[model samples]
Target: MNIKELQQYVSRFCDEKGFEGIPLETRVMYLISEIGELTDDLLEIKGATTEKQEVIKRNIGHEMFDVTWNIFDLANKLDIDLEAAFKEKMNINENREWKT
Candidate 1:
């Protein structure tokens, strides 16, 4: 599905399963925490920390998805319609590029 479809689908899934509780900021924090964990995994192999590389990589995928989902959630919450907005912005960019 496209971005808007996916946003609608996720919203439906969230509503159907009674999965509402945390605030947007909390989701953002979780996303940041995941990014930190992923970074730790990458850095640990270079003697930067003690976390395991393989384990951290696995968690990183989940965290990255968390980050993506929240971005979609925010988009949907604000009725921003990212799929169309992106297209609109790209058209402007295409018209403006190298126009000096």
Candidate 2:
């Protein structure tokens, strides 16, 4: 689904699971925790054998999803329209010049 749909799904899921009352700061902490998990998965993959790397790769995807889900939930809590914000930011980036 698109960003808007994903945001709606997260909103509904949070409401259904009684997470709608969670504070923004707590949501940010959850997102940070997920990021740490994803980082751990990356580090594990780096040191893993080829066979073990495949397993860590799957866990990395799940961790990434968790990060994204928390972000969507945070945006919903903040009443931010991420889709519009993303488009606006991309437009600015598209027209900007890089020094490199």
Q: Which candidate is the best by TM-score?
A: 2
| TM-score quality measure for candidate 2 | 0.94
Reference-based TM-score of each model: 0.59, 0.94
Query: Runs in model 2 with CA error above 4 Å?
Result: none
Scored against the true structure, residue 87 in model 2 reaches a CA lDDT of 99
What is each predicted model's overall lDDT from 0 to 1?
Answer: 0.70, 0.94
Cα distance off (Å), candidate 2, residue 69? 0.8
- Provide the lDDT at 37 for model 2: 97
Candidate 1 residue runs with Cα over 4 Å from true position: 19-27, 45-56, 95-100
Estimate, for each residue in 1-100, the C-alpha lDDT of model 2 and write its tens digit: 9999999999999989999999999999999999999999998888799999999999999999999999999889889999999999999999999998
Which residue pairs show collisions in model 2?
Answer: none
Best by lDDT: 2
